[model samples]
Target: MSPTHFISIPVASPGITENLRKFQDLCGEKIHPHKVQYPSKLHLTIGVLKLFSDEEVQQACNCLSEFSAKIPPILCEQPLHGTLKNLRVMRGDNQFVKVMYSEFILSDDSDRLQNLADKCLEFFVERGFMEYQYNTTAVKLHCTLINTRWNNAGPRTINASEILSDEFELQIFGNCVLDRIDLNEMRADKSFVAENDKRYLNVSCVSFK
Candidate 1:
């Protein structure tokens, strides 16, 4: 798959970003420096897509608008509030993990968040804009914190011993409040412009609030 774009909830809250930096500092000696995510690049992804042309990108933009318009007034008027309270391994395999992420604990109704994710995924997939491997019935919200892929050195997996220590077990990454969904560029381009220090190319964004 070309995998050009993805839908994501941007995380730029001041308290959250500051705490993320603190979390990274605590992890500095263990994980490779390249593997840590920049605070500006932090986000909770909804779905990935493969759009190959301008028309396709614009169509995806249209779909975002349509999806945003249909939301209920109660859910749409305010931000989707949540917290980053725990760290998790991808697929629960801590021995050989390519990704370590912070769990998103929604303070708002969990089912409402699930339904929103399901409906959003359904909207894009049914229209042939995106095909998500994320289960449509239950989508777990998470923001990736460490990725081994960025490390150019030998093995690209972090072992159990290399995982975060017990001190981080009850550690809170930060609180997240998101209202907008962006169809943004997944592949990084050096020539792209940055919006408020965000490096990704944003084709379109629709605010639920």
Candidate 2:
């Protein structure tokens, strides 16, 4: 299902943005600027919710509020620190890549972050929020840096085989802290493209305790 809304953890550190901006700038014309992810939009999505009405949206918002109060136990009163891994392509060959993202591997190689995401999804699912389902066993958290679907001026896929160079090092964004989770409303078309209008709305947010 296409997501009308999603629950995500914001990767808002300045260093993270600066690193991404530098890499995007280096790519220049090789990658469509239209498809490149804006620094402000970077986030690690947990899962999407298909809320079709105002009441359903409210229900999801309430879930965030209640879920946060219980986060201290799941997280042990600490924020999640994610180490940014190297850039990777999704779903296909590297020559015809469509989705390029940086995986956020949690600190100490522990499953704390993944477990937290699972718990949050279970919390909402039990409340009848109608979480948008995916084919994978679980939603993988990653920060998308480029997606060809967002650009119309070029072909559907880019030849990314040649660009994985030393210029883009592993863990480019370094360690990132995630202290807040948010529920944001997507655009009417459910696209992340910020062409002429705001791509997402900040409906609700909860900081970890």
Candidate 3:
């Protein structure tokens, strides 16, 4: 069976990408450039689907399209403002840091975003596309800045406290408008630079109110 694909919303703001690029450059100076994420590929994942075949992927896409059509468009009162505050790592029960990402917080401190994510998960679960088990303790709305799955294989630890000292604590990546939700196929060969290209097909875009 093929690997499972993901459902997510792409962050298309150029300002956000440029700011993240600067952070990546800093990480390059401290760690390795390739270890950091390409700014262009920043996204907020909605849910993961256990799609192993082409037919399943198509069915998932159709499901998302129908699910989106019924709901009103997602809206933010003030152009969703987010801040890249701290650097954190995701650890499993074995205490292995599998993924590294930036902590994102909205200025409004609203639950609307989390509600949207829950809705996405609910839609997939009800349709038998995904399991009902909760992956994380809570649905943390975030943007993945770096993932070591492709770059590094061994278990490692990073001193986030030392690295985040001084002015690097909080970085405002600028505001973004949540206009569309795209169902994208996860591909191993895809990089941040190729995200804007036609290689990735948007199976469905959730309409906004």
CA RMSD per model (angstroms): 2.9, 3.4, 4.0
TM-score of candidate 3 to 2 decimals = 0.76
In candidate 1, stretches whose alpha carbon ends up further than 4 angstroms from where it belongs are: 73-76, 134-137, 153-155, 160-165, 189-198
Per-residue lDDT of model 2, residues 17-110, tens digit only? 6787677677767788778877677788888888888988888898899998778888877668877668888778888889999888878677
Task: Please identify which of the two predictions, 1 or 3, would achieve the higher TM-score against the true structure.
Answer: 1
List model 3 lDDT by residue over 1-209, tens digit each: 54367777666567777777677666554445555566655677777666777888788888888887545544343345555555665655323344666655666777666667777777877888866545652356667765555556433444454454565634566566665567766664343345433234455566554
| TM-score, model 2 to reference | 0.86
RMSD after Cα superposition, model 2: 3.4
User: What is the C-alpha local distance difference test score of candidate 2?
Assistant: 0.77
Clashing pairs in 2: none
Candidate 1 lDDT tens digits, 95-129: 78788888767786555666677788888889997
Candidate 2, which segments miss by more than 4 Å at Cα? 131-137, 165-171, 188-199
